[model samples]
Target: MRTIQPIPFRLLLSAVLLAPCALPAQPRGPVGSVRGTVYDSLTRKPIVDAVIEVQATAQITYSDAQGRFTLDSVPLGVQQLTFSSATLDSLGLYGFAREVDVTSDTRGVLLTTPSFGTMYGRLCATAGSPSRDSAIVFGTVYDAASRTPLSKAQVSLRWLQSSEGGKELSNPERTTATGDDGVYGICGLPADVALTTTAQHDAIVSGAFNTVVGPSRMLRRDFYISRELGQAADVRTNATPSSGSGIVRGTVRYERGKALPGALVSLIAGNRSTETDAEGQFRLTGVPLGTQELNVQQIGRGGVSRAIDVTARDDGTHDFVLRGTTVLATMNVRGKVGADQAGFLRRKQDGMVRVVEREEILKRSDIGSALKRLPGLRVAQKLGGTVIEATRPMCVGQVPIVIDGALIPNPRNTTTFSVPQALSGTTAIPRATTTPAPSRAAQSSVVSAANNARVDQLMVNDVLAIEFHPGPASVPMEYWPGPPPQCGLLLIWTVASNWDK
Candidate 1:
C-alpha cells in the first residue's frame, strides 16, 4: 500500500499489457499444405524437373523423380502455378507449358504432363555417300587449346533473312553450344533444310609471365545428308505410329530392366500435349500420327530427354530405356572471323559503298550480328576506293567462304547470299553483266578482287551454314593445295524458288 496511490498511470499500463499475455497465443500459419503429383497424360507417370512456378509472385519449385512436389509456406491467397520443361526435353510437335490456379477451397493441384516437338534425323556429310562414322557432323562448339570442352560456345546454322536486294539471303543463325563432351545435338529445328555448325572459342591463356595470352580461334565445318542419313526404311523400322483411334502405348524401364515406377512420360504430338499415368506405363490414343516425340522427364540430372517416335497407326507399343544424358561444353570464339562473314556490305544511294554488318546485319537477328561480332575482323578499303569491306590480318587469320560444297571466290561475294539487302539509307543499283562470271577463282586472288556483282538465287535459308576455316594453320595437311579432292562446303540452296513444285 506504500506506493499504490502514487502509481495510477503506470499501474494502468501494466494491467493492460498483462491482459494480452493472459490470452492464449495465436496459431502459426494456416494448418494445411497443398500437395500433388505431376504426370504426363500420354505416359502415365510423374514428371521430374518440371518447374512449378507460382503465378502470383513468380516464385518457383520443381517436382521430384517420383513426380511428387510440395509447396511449403504457401500463404492463403489466390495462387497460380505452371509447368514447363526445356525445349529439347521431348519430341512432340510441341512442348509442355501449362498453368494451374489454387485458392482457399483448393489445397492440392495435379499437373498434366506436356509434349515436346521433335527434330529427328541422322548425321552425315552427304546423301547416298559413304558414312563418315565419326566424320558425321553432330554439332559444333569452341573447345580449349588442349581440346578440353567448354560450355555455351557460340554456334550457328544457316537460315533465311529479309534483305533490301529482294533476293533470298543466307546468314549464320545462332544455336546451342557443346555439351561437356564437346558435343551438341538438338531437334525441332526447321525441317527439310540442311544445317551446318560453326563454333568459336574466346579464351585467354598465358604462355609465360608478363606476356599476353594466346589469341583465341574460331572453328567451323559444313556437313550435309546423304540420302541414306535416314531413309524411309530406317524410319519404318525404328518408328511406328499407334493404330486404332491413334492411341499409342509405351513403358519406361531402366537399362537394368526395372520399370521406372511413377516416372513421368509423354507423347509429343506436333502440337505439344500429352497423357501420363501413375504406373510406369502410358496410352496416348487419338494422337496424330505424324512423327511424334516421346520424352521422359529427368530430375536433378541435366541432359537430353529420352526421345522416340509415334508413327501413324491405330495402336502400337514402343519401349524406351534412356542411357546417360550428355552435358554440352562451352567455347570461346572471341577473336576470329568465318567464311561468308559479312561487314554489312552495301551500296550507298550516292554511289558510295558502305560495309555495314555492325548495324544492318545485327538488326535482323542475333546470328547475323555475329558476322561482325569478332574483334579480329577489320573494315578495309581496297587501297584506292572507299567501298567498306572486311579483311583479316595477313598472319592473324582468314575465313573461307563456300556455297553448297564449292567455295565462293571471295568472302565478300558470299555475303550476298546471307545479307541479301542493303543497310538502311543505302541502295543497290544492279549492273548488267554480259557474261557469266567464273564460278571458282584462286582463293588468294578473289580476296583481293572487287566487283559490284551478285550471285543468282541468293537465299539465306538455302545456304546451310557460314563455315569458318582458320587458314592453313587449322587445316590438316590432307586438305591443303587447291580444293580438296572432296566437297568442303556443301550447298543446299534451291536453284529455283519454286523447285519443290
Candidate 2:
C-alpha cells in the first residue's frame, strides 16, 4: 500500500526473493505417545518406581505403583526404550531394553526384566580324575552316540551371587570354546554359588546342567551330546546306525489303580530322568539299548525298580505299581526331591496342581510353548504374544498368572462396545432396547485381565517350575490371599535351586 514498493525494480525484486527466508518459521508436526508397563520375567510382577527412557530423546518417565508408564511427544518411528529400577537391580535383575515402532499412539507394550540364578559343576575326562581346576569346567565335549570328543564346542556359565550386604549380584556370564584337548573352564566365579551350565556343539543336542558349588569341592559334570533322530541318521548314512539308543515309554500308578503324577523315572545307567504327567504317563527318549534298570519314585510313596531289555528303536509300554506304605527309611528319595519348603512336589501337594519342571521347560524355546502342551488350557496368540486362557466352561474371572510368588497384571479390553441381541415379539413396533450392563463378575474379569502380565515374555530355560490350577476351587490357600480369580490360576516359580530337575 505504500509508495516505497515502486521506488526501484531491483529493490522490489530483491524483497520478493527474500520474503520466504525473512518470514517466521511454521510449527512442527505433532508427535506421538508411547505407553506400557515393565514386569519381572521371573516373578511376573510390575516394577514400580522404575525409570523408563527413550534413547536419543529427552522423553522419560517413571512407572507408577501399577508399573504403568507413559512417554509423550516421542518422535514417530522406531525407538529404543530402556527400563531400570534400583530395587530390581539389587535382586540380581537387569533392566529391559526393547525397540518399538511408534508410528502413532502406542499401548500394551510389555517388557520383562530377567533375573539371574547360579549353577556350578566340574568337567572331567571319561577315565581321568577331575580335570585340573583351569580345565575342570571346560572339558572336551563329546557326541553321546559316537563317544568321539568334539572340538571347538561352546561352554557357558550363568549365575548370580550374593554380596556382603545380602544383596544379589549378577556376574558378567562366562562363555568359552573347547580347546584341542576337548577341555574348557570358566574362571572368576564366586565360591559356594549355584549356576546353570550348558555345552553346545555342532549338530549335537545341547546339554544343560544345574548344580551348586561346594567350598573347594571339585564337582565332576560331563556332557553327552546326541543328535536328533534325523540328524543322527544323516550323519551315519555310510555306516550302520548305533544299536545303543532307543526310546522308553511307561506309566506309574498306585497299587489301588490311581495314577501317580510327578513320579521321577530314571534310567540308572543312562542318568536320564523324567517325571510322569497328570495321567501318570512318562516317556524317556534316547535310552541306551541294553539291560537297563529303571527306578521310579514319588513323594510320600515307596520307590520301585524294574529290569528291562531295551532294543534299538523299540517303542513299548512298561508300567510300575507303587504301593502306598510308610516312607522308606533307606529309600534316599530325598536327594532327588529336595526338603526345601518351596520344593515343586511339596507345593503341588498343597492343592490340585499340575507342575512342569525345569527339565521339561528347557526342552522348549519359550514358556508359552511349554504351557500349550498342558491339558485344559488354551494358549492363544494375541496382538502382542501368546496368552493362556482357561478352557473350562464354568470359569468366570480372568485366570491369574503368578510367577515366583508374584501376581502379574492381566491384559484388558479398553472399549465398552456391546453387541445387539435378538428379541422375539409379535408387535409391529421395533424396540430400541439398550444392551444390558455388564455384571459384577464380568467387570471383575475385565479388570483382572487388564492388569495381568504378558506370559510370552517369560523364557522357558529361566523357569524353575510352573503350576496350573484349572479352577478357583483348586487354587492353593496361599495363592488366594488377595482377590481370587474366578476362572483359575497359573503359578510360576523361577528362583531355581541346584536341586531343581
Candidate 3:
C-alpha cells in the first residue's frame, strides 16, 4: 500500500516560476525586515505551518495561523524567497516561488499557487457554474511493483445530493483515464460534498479513497496497483485465462479455530466457483481484477458477502462469523447463499415489484430481449444505445438502472457514455461506417463492436434476477425520493453480488 512520494513534480514546477520572468530592479536598498502571507492561489485558503525561507541565507520562518510570516534584519535587496509545506506537497499545491525587494521594512508581501481557473480552462462541463461552484479532482495512478506511473488506468469519483426527506436525489459519477504520464483529471465535480473514488488498470484495482472535498479549485488523489500473478489466473474461465488477473484466496473458519469444510464460495459476478477443502481453505483464481462482491454460504448456516477489491496482491480473505440458522429447503447444489434466496422470496411478496427468476433469465440471449418479455416495459434506442423505458402512460422517461447495491448515474454534463445505459445492453457503441459489410462474419463483428461501445447491454447468462418498478408508486417507499427518477426503476441482480432490496 506504499506510494512513490516526493515525485519531483513540485520541484520542477517551482523552478519554472522562479526563473526569468524579467523582474525590473528597484531603488537602492539595505538590510530590512520583511513580512508576507501565504495562501493557496486556487482555493484562497490560508495555508498555515508552511516554511518560508530566504534563499541562500539561514533566515527561515514558518507561517502562523493566518499564513503570516516575518523575518527581521534580513539582507533582502532582491532576495530569493521560497515557501513550502508537507500539506502543500500532499495537496499538490506546492511549486511556487517569489522574489522580494526590501528597501526598508517590507509589508503586504504575498505568495500563492497558480490559478486553477487558468489551469483547467473549459476542460469539462459542470452542473453549476464551471468556476468556483465546481471543482476538479486529478491524480496519478501508479504500478505498485514498478513504483511507476501507469497509463490508460481508470479513476472514478462519485457523490450524491439528497433531499431532507431521505428520498435519493442526484447521484453523479465521473470517470477518466490516465494519460501517458499516468495522471488523470476529472473536472466539474460539485464542491462541499463527500466523494468516493476507485482506480483500476486492467484487472488490478485500488482500495477506495474517500474525502470530503471542500469548495476548492482542485484536489489530488493517487493510487498504487500491483499486477496479477503471471501463471495463476481464473480457473473457472473456459477460454485461456489472461495473465492480467488475480487470485481471491481465503479460509472459511468457525470461531475457536474450527475450519468449516465443504463450505461454498463464489463471486457474485458469477462463473467462478469453488468450495473449501478439509482445512476450510478456499481459493478462487482469476477473479476479474477490480471491485467485486463475493458471497459465501454453508448449509444449515447463513450467508455473508462483502465488496472486495480484487488485485494481484490481496489478503482479502472473507472471515465471517455467522451463527447457524435454520436449514434451507431450497439450497442449490452449488451452495447458493440462503440470504440471497430468502431476500429474493421476500421481495417477490411485494405487489409493485416484478421479479424474473434465473431459469427465464438463462433462456434469453441479451438484456433487451429479456426485459421486453416483462409486462409494462419496452426497449428504445437513444444516443446510439438501448434505453429501458416504462410503458406506463404517465411514466414515459428512461428507467434508472441499478446494478447490485449501486446506482449507475447519468449526469447532464457527461461527454462520454451515459453510465445508466452501462447496464442497458452488453454491446459496444457502434462506430461510424463508410459502407455496409459484404460478409456475414465482418458484419457481426462490427455490430458487436458498436454494442460494446454503447455500454447498454449485457449477456443474459450473467444475470440472476431482474426487478422492475413501473412507477414511483411501484417503487418501494424506502428507496424512493419523492419527485425525482419519475420514470421508474430497473434493478439488476447480477451474478456479481447477492445484494437485494
TM-score of 1: 0.21
The numbered model that scores best in lDDT is 3
Error of 1 at 194 (Å): 6.8
Q: Candidate 3 regions off by >4 Å? A: 1-29, 122-129, 161-171, 228-501
Question: Candidates 1 and 3: which is better by TM-score?
Answer: 3
Off by over 4 Å in 2: 1-138, 162-171, 229-244, 247-501
Candidate 1 residue 393 Cα shift, in angstroms, is 24
Measured against the true structure, the TM-scores of the candidates, in listed sequence, are 0.21, 0.31, 0.43
- lDDT per residue for candidate 2 within 371-462, as digits (tens), equals 86555566766554555676543233346665544445432322222212221111121222334445556755552343233355456666
lDDT of 2: 0.53
Q: Encode model 1's per-residue lDDT on 130-213: one tens digit a residue.
A: 211211123323221223444544334433333576433434343544445444443223333233232333421100000011
What C-alpha lDDT do the candidate models reach, one value each? 0.33, 0.53, 0.58
Overlapping backbone residue pairs in candidate 1 total 76
Distance from true location, Cα of 339 in model 2, Å: 20
Q: How much is 104 displaced in model 1, in angstroms?
A: 4.9
Worst 10-residue lDDT window, candidate 2: 1-10
Task: Sort all candidates by TM-score, best to worst.
Answer: 3, 2, 1
